[model samples]
Target: MTQIAEAVIDENGQIPLMEPLHVIGPHRALVTVLDEPPAGWDETLMAAEKALADDWLRPEEDEAWAHLQ
Candidate 1:
């Protein structure tokens, strides 16, 4: 049986499982660390901020799209 759980490691290099194992006495497990955010996070935010900074609703732009409004 395979089980997956998320845990944080303490300063003493120990991670406490949130739940008990169903299988009996001794078992082997694998631990992986996910310490970084997803890729392109900063770039996505910067692009969004740049888009908001543009004058998309200016008088000229508004008139151009007045039919839609």
Candidate 2:
């Protein structure tokens, strides 16, 4: 299994879904992310913050969290 795909929550307080994604085409896909994932999501999020540092993601996308490389 892979780790979580990171995203930031929008002003609406919603994050982007990351997994179970299916691409219908270049412009469309389905994805999922747990607001509170089981086990170590908190730790994962923290680690992601450290990983991100001063980098900037697309704020318009509402990327409160970001997927770490």
> How do all models score by TM-score?
0.43, 0.27
Which ten residues in a row are the worst by lDDT in model 2? 60-69
Over the stretch 16-63, how does candidate 2's per-residue lDDT look in tens digits?
Answer: 654654445455333555566556668888988965764654573345
Candidate 1 whole-model C-alpha lDDT, 0 to 1: 0.76
Model 2: runs farther than 4 Å from truth? 1-36, 57-69
Collision count of model 2: 7
